[model samples]
Target chain A: MSLVTDKIISKPKIETRDLGLEMTENNRSLIEISNFDFFYGEKQALFDVSMDIKEREVTAFIGPSGCGKSTLLRCINRMNDLIEVARIGSGKITVNGVDIYDDRVDTIELRKRVGMVFQKSNPFPKSIYENVVYGLRIQGITRKSKLDEAVERCLKGAALWEEVKDRLDTSGLSLSGGQQQRLCIARALAVEPDILLMDEPCSALDPVATAKVEELIHTLKDRYTIVIVTHNMQQAARVSDRTAFFYLGKLIEMNATDQIFMSPDKEQTEAYISGRFG
Target chain B: MKRYFHEELEEIRSHLMLMGEKAVESVKLAMQALLESDIELANQVMESDDVIDDIEKQIDDEVVRYVSLRAPVARDLRLLFVAIKASHDLERVGDEASNIAGRTKKILAQGLPIDAVARVPRMCELAINMLEDSLRSFIQEEESLAYSIVGRDREVDTLNRENFKELVELMKSDSANVSACTEMVFISKSFERIADHAKNIAEEVFYLLTAQSLKEVTRGK
Candidate 1:
């Protein structure tokens, strides 16, 4: 056979540091954390963590136990204020070009714009319709037709309207585990929050239910900036656009979910994915 | 931590080397038998073909088991995949060796004067050397050496074509030697096939080392 002599073009090597950096100034992130640090009393939790959460994209936080993934999630909505010893120092968290922690910033107004769903589905024992309209009612929306419309819109947005529409008068606790979680999501959306934080939202559910919750998260990203904290590596892989890996209160690496799952830049991330000592 | 994966890989390599050595030895014996008209040595090469067939089956089984169990990806998977292809080519090379041996037996039984025997022995030697080099390149993971072997295949094709024309002239010049010349033609065809198998081995070696399709690379050029 005659030998062919074409030159092969090789791909250029990209440095790890160059990845995940937003190159253009015009595409500024919706949420930006600049050298953020957190402390519980004298014990520090997060150290010089800085990253961006882009607008309308799902960003997943993953790490081993006690690595501050949940703590970091709570810091976004100032949920750490519930803890007596919690303190944030040395950095700033800004959403839509404004700092939420400023002295003049209103915590109540900030919470209305940043809603959250907990690990467990902690629905109120009240009726399903009351649970969904609870946030709107607290905002002083008392008109019956407005509350009814908001309830329908938010339930459909959470992908739970069809199942609970006939049972609007039933107790929120009467629904299954997966439906209750979606009820919690619908409650979070009832406030019309710009950013939604989920802390292991599917950890308590089975695989089939978890798939439904994951699908809901994907649908929610069209209108809201979503940040999720999950211990399940495969769940993060299947849902998130970008993933951040935290270890020992430090942000080890963050990149596109595909890169983190297939070939992570950090050795720790690789070890975790390969099932070699988390 | 399974030892069987690495052990099977090493076992496959050893069997390939043994088969390669047998093919070289068969060609050498066939050439010697042709020069001395030793029908006995020619018959010995033909009778030993069963051993080559048995080794081919063994290699095939080892490759299939490793692939089904390991499900290896990237370089490890490429090596196992190429091992399967190389095993088939080596089996065909064994078949070519047997054909050469059978032709040597026929020419010896006829007791005819072989005019093209000199060129035939040189072609056989070149084919055997190429096979040996291709295996060495695989064992060493030398991609450059593999590419060089692939580049040299055209030389073997040229030698086969030249020998075919010269053998035809011998048959036309002496009508009584038609049967022997026909056997010589078969021997030349066997050498050509052996060269082709060596070229295949080289291509597989290149693929196993680089994870690039050799056919695509050559075609792109």
Candidate 2:
């Protein structure tokens, strides 16, 4: 980044720590991870970590790489189950009061309720309209009118409709990196998932694209319980209502994003965020 | 691990300390000029104020650069906040000292009796003490010392109020010297304002340390 030469001499406004994003009685818990421990074969990956994610809130998981932030995120949707060596060592994860690991729970249904966008934009080899309706098509909804409505609604929900409405017939891969990410987001919204999990969805894009994706996250946060895992601390500070700092597989501190960014409770969290940590 | 940006942060800290020292010197010399009726020392205080202003600009530039390039957070972020605010307060203290020197020059030119300006020396002492202690608290990160500076401001305020009343009486009784006594009133107020800036700087230090407003912290007590 080039140095900013414009001198902006303004008094710094000291903000009140609380940003009024506190989880009140109305903000019910949507996902609960209790004493959750996990292992990849014999190597333990997650310590006894626990936190309650509230509905309609954006909770960010931030830490150095290999700190189990992504591991914990994957555990929320049981995405780690795909790895043959990965297994839950102890404790349970409940989504809306239902133990997702229980034998009776369908992984497919669990995934439909909790959608995920990856670190990379993975728009399938399909048209823009086809990509948005892909989730519905898998559920055996093949009617053109129904799929068309889902395409419009989901694309609009993801803040991509205006730019891509005319390009519905174009390949999803043909869009720019940012457009592709938003297209993937539109696909996630097609299922009308109650929770949206984003894993560094803007890491690959330029600042303009990153800003668009962050704006989309801000808009989507009020309607869906959003959990984002990102290596960019500033992005976490900007987009998250609540931020959780993790280190060495242990949850260090979790608090309102304003408090976490301004004055984190833990010394380790402070060191890490301030770039003083080893 | 120390980041590459740590040096820039330390640079801003050093500049702030230097600015504090210059601001203190300005106040001390302004008072000395008044006591000795030295027009040369008074002019020097007025001229040296430009240095304090330039340092404030320099600190502001570095702070903005660090915030934009490095993206500081937590205590580092709080330090930036304090750096901006404390430097501004120091700059205002510089202005107050200059105003006092300007008024001192007016008193000396009129050949005013120095007897009417007795309380000002004490006021200047309290103000300088507060400013120095505030800077010390910042350097030492001493919370209690910063907290103590806030309370001591009342003594300086009371002295300024006394000076104002006595100067008013002198103006009424000694009609021939009313012009010089009027200058004394503003000089006393400038000292009081210097103390106020010092108190503000101390509150900023408290905020940098605890991330809590000193006013909010003491309001409960």
Candidate 3:
């Protein structure tokens, strides 16, 4: 696999077959969350939620405000650990059948395998080349030839190389809002994460820019497992292979995107996706 | 609380219902014209077909617009798809009714006896009933009612086959009545086609309500 590079320090060793999960070209489960609960200090935020996201497919999380879609997304890579009060209440989340929350697992190595793009694009106030290669630089890969190659490969992977190829040395912040978001995506790709988590990646962008980012996401899924949390039902319908609907910090329903949008098994999912309720 | 574009869906729905009403009305008028041998009523049935055709176009346009702009999902999305497909079936129903009326006009011009179209009225009544029930099933979200209508189409088909045999026999028995018998056979076939269209709408409504194929479900039986 082109995405499984040397940078991914420790690939989770547990196989899908060993986990007794069904395996297919499109449905090989890459991430499994079983009976997982989460909390923000004393307040519970996620109930016993569970689902398996397939490898190399886009899985979208959709629900109303404060519904814990983003919380669950952050848990996949332990992003919630940065919050002072956040903690796992129970259960486990595993990538390749290995518990991500395991003490033996390295957090840095875990994040290197699961990159995230924020709703707002945050460029590091450096040149575009530097932004793409920042993760590698921080890891002490300072050879000029290595950095140059990483920058080009990451930028191309992000679908931004053609737009900003002429201005490689220009400040990352100098790009348009959409270009900046793609730049952030390029930055995420620099580490060649096995999974990409995006939280409303297009909410801050214009429709045209949103379309470009969506297009990038469509192509990126070929090389990465993508999980997106979005309030936009149409965006979820357009981009995801599978869709999970959460409500009040509980997993309400999760199914194929076509089934979720066309005729969801649960009325709660139908109600939310159709804007019939909060 | 409903969304604003739901009114648009309602409008599309109303347009579809109006088209259904017009289709049923067309078939009824064509039947009445054939029974009474009324040339004026037959002409009226033929002329009013444009109304059903126009409503179908309007329903199609609204469905397309709603799908593109409203971005409906789940039940609402299914309703849009049903609207498009059911409207097409209703349009064909309108066409079949018009064809029946045209044949009725030809028979009336020849001064043929109304009894020549022996099994047609029965077929028309069965088909129209099925059509009404299909439309009702759609409006009320009645899945069983829609499934019930699919089997009823076979009854209309049987009557049409009998009519074809009877009309063919009448033609051979009396060469003088051949033209009238020929028109009756086509009219009977038109009614059969209308019933087929009605069955299609029923299947569509079944899908709209349950998202299951009536054909596939019934195929196993």
Maximum-TM-score candidate: 3
Worst 10 residues of 1 chain B by lDDT: B1-10
lDDT by residue (B23-79, candidate 1, tens digit) is: 667777766777777788878877777787788788777666555434456877777
Q: Which digits, one per residue and each the tens of the lDDT, describe model 2 over residues B75-128?
A: 999999999999999999999999999998888888666568778889989999
Deviation in Å, model 2, residue A164 alpha carbon: 1.1
Top lDDT model: 2
lDDT for model 2 comes to: 0.87
Q: Report i-RMS for every model.
A: 14.0, 9.6, 9.0
| Residue-level lDDT tens digits of model 1 in A1-278 | 11110111122323212222223233347788889999999999999899998878889999999899999999887777777788897898987766666654555556667799999999999999999999888879999999999999999999899999998999999999999999999999998887899999999998778878888887888788899999887778767888999998899999987678766899998887667964
- Candidate 3 CAPRI-style tier: incorrect
- lDDT string for model 3 (A16-82, tens) is 3433323325568889999999999899999999999999999999999999999999999888867
Model 3: lDDT of residue B41:
88
Task: State which candidate, 2 or 3, has the greater TM-score.
Answer: 3
Q: Which regions of candidate 2 deviate over 4 angstroms?
A: A1-26, B1-184, B187-221
- Interface quality of candidate 3 as DockQ: 0.06
* Backbone collision tally, model 1: 0
